[model samples]
Target: MKNIEPKIKKLTADILKDYGQGRTIDKMNAFTSPDMDVVVDILDKLQKILFPGYYRNKNYHFYTAENNLQTLIEDVLFNLTKQISMYLRYLPEYSNADYRTGMERAQEIAMEFLSRIPKIRDLVETSVQAEFDGDPAAFNKDEIIFCYPGMYAIMVFRLAHEFYDLGVPMLPRIMSEYAHGKTGIDIHPGATIGRFFFIDHGTGIVVGETTVIGDNVKVYQGVTIGALSTRGGQNLRSKKRHPTIEDNVTIYSGASILGGETVIGHDSVIGGNTFITMSVPPGSNVSIKSQELHISSKGRPDAEAKDLDQSATWFYTI
Candidate 1:
């Protein structure tokens, strides 16, 4: 190969010159920003604390739960507070405040979030039970907790929702994105999800911000409770943009329920592959019109049966 040192030097010079443009993308000063890797590490530690003994690292052995939890909780709080403080220091409102003041506020937020762990756990219990009750394949809660991507996604969502409620910036979304990357389920931390929620075979599920899901709601994979459009962009911020799902509603897989005004009313069953953009009345069963099916044996043109109706009607109550 030809000597490449000159090319490498030129490339380095070009990148350095690009950094001088002063765009946000060119920034990488960790002291001024929270590290994503550290945020993910904090998430891992939080998971270990949330589901004790399940996610314990090989380096740690739990003789008693309290001993392990004490260390784990302290570690999470310290790191969480540090990351929050780093984020707060750069905000416009905190720009004039002393660094210690930002740290104090961050500590307060972290403490408040930690205090709600029991409440979060209670909601998670309901979610696990919902999953077990909603899915025939789920043998037990342990399997759902350890093996289900949906359960893992919801666990992270519950954790991140606490921080989102606390009004801490950046970190909540970072934690949520970590879960999304791990599981193909994208649930916004800002979404208000109710108790006893279940997501079966969850992948390509998008729950947008401003979505309000009621209790006992079960959603299948490829479901999107999202906006009809985002053409308004920031003009629509803090406004209702996603659909509302009332209690006891079962939305099947590949159903796209869109628009702020769209509501899957209570006790409704939305069928698979349905596209909904309008509100449906209570106790409604919404589905696509039945399509014709054809059956034939290979090399038997005379035996072909065309336009066969779909006869199997399924119903669920959860």
Candidate 2:
């Protein structure tokens, strides 16, 4: 055991060293990297804070609500500030400073962000209202907030957007990815979304970093507002790549709207499975017709129905 232990320790120690490869970081400075788990924990706490009665613990008495909330807020603030400081340390700008000095900026940013919680709550409430209004199955705003994946995704995006707006790197992406993993709705923190925006069904939705969405826009599941091309690589960083969605637009499921030059103008109704790459004028009702459709007999995959009737087509009055 002693002989084998020495060999294993040496191998482990060798791999621990950077070896001039930027991929490996030193263990002593491990705290400089953001903690993903802690950031998610912060999100969980923020959720309860954002919607107070929705996640109440029955064990806690009514009189204890304020005290419990206060403690939770303080705990989340401390952990978030620590993680933010660590994230900032990864940049060349903050690497030269001592821990206390580096954390000062983090503290300031965290305080400013916390102060905006009321506004965030208001924005999220409007998003919930949008979901409730858009979905026929949704019973109420409370149900929408509790059950809708789009609402959950939007809530996280709004929080992450605050961090992104404050110019705090890494943490915003972490928050967005956390939501994307849970909700299957990929809304980039860098995306500028206006008030009362909702995504129905929400699964497989991809909203790119450069996408700009105005108020009162509704999108169904499997929607992609993405780039026309990515061959430009890092050369296109911070350049507009995704499409712009104007107000009062309804993009249905499985639709792909690509390119920065592509804009869905106001009061537009984009149909399901539509693939668009060019700009759409305002008040346009875009849809594809004459597409072939095949259906299988009930409970029989081998029995196929003939193509859809050419004269029969689905349409929406916008």
Candidate 3:
């Protein structure tokens, strides 16, 4: 009994020591209550501003409209600038001096971003109209603007892309990634996407950095607009690495379009389940056909082969 007690005490002490040394605590610190929610909240406020009456409560009186909007704008600017500054401090790409200067730069960038809100709002309005026109089941623009996850994702991406262009590190990616996590539409912060862009049932979609997508484009689920490789980044850092999708193109589900120099022409229809690495011509239809397979045997056929020869036993192609 005495020996067993000593062994049990040693085991407990070893377990406690291992627990202290394990990556569980590190993971908790890294993942618990992410600071990215600050950026998400800023994006939510921007959404409210973009669609004033439709988004938030329309309680502002005639006299309070300008004053309330101004106050909200200033508050959002302050919080976003502060968060950008904080993010710069942690970004390994920037120096300490850069981090210190980033605060003032963030203020300038935030103001510039705010100034573009009118234009952004116009773009979002057009997108809402597009959604209403595109989806047959949609009741009205309000339902799309308020409830559609795709619209929410696009709004966040557009706002984040503006900040990304202003060279605000980490915060832009954080905001875009938050939208991606929520909507399953992975639009990179550096991607340049134009107005009236629609993502229908957007799941497993990847838009790589440096991608350029034009207006009135529609993408379905499981579409991958990605890079061919990062092998050139072994020596280069700012090289173009994603595909360029022109206007009015529709990429169907499960299609992978990859390459840095791959330019998808305008008014093209990319069919479902197609794998494309090269560029497609304008107004072309790209699709993949299932290959037919035949089975035969020269040796003596056994009972297993006879069983496999039946049409019911053979696996069919999609």
Clashes of each: 0, 0, 0
Better of 1 and 2 by lDDT: 1
Give the top-scoring candidate (lDDT). Answer: 1
Q: For residues 292-313, write the lDDT of model 1, one tens digit per residue.
A: 1111122212211122222423
lDDT tens per residue, model 2, 142-228:
888788889999999999999999989889999999999999999999999999998899999999999999999999999999998
User: Where does model 2 exceed 4 Å of error?
Assistant: 1-29, 57-64, 291-318
Task: Assess every candidate by TM-score.
Answer: 0.88, 0.83, 0.77
lDDT: worst 10-residue window of model 1: 292-301
Q: Could you give me the TM-score of model 3 versus the true structure?
A: 0.77
Higher-ranked by TM-score: 1 or 3:
1
Name the better of 1 and 2 by TM-score.
1
Tens-digit lDDT track of model 3 for 1-318 = 558988999999997777776584633444322376677778777877887676663554446667767867977999888877666655555446464587786687788989989877787777787788888989987789778888888888878888788777788888888898898989998998888898887888999988899999999889999988777665545667788898888889998888878887777778787777766555555655565211223232433334333322222242
lDDT values, one for every candidate: 0.84, 0.83, 0.76
Candidate 3: deviation at residue 130, Å? 1.9
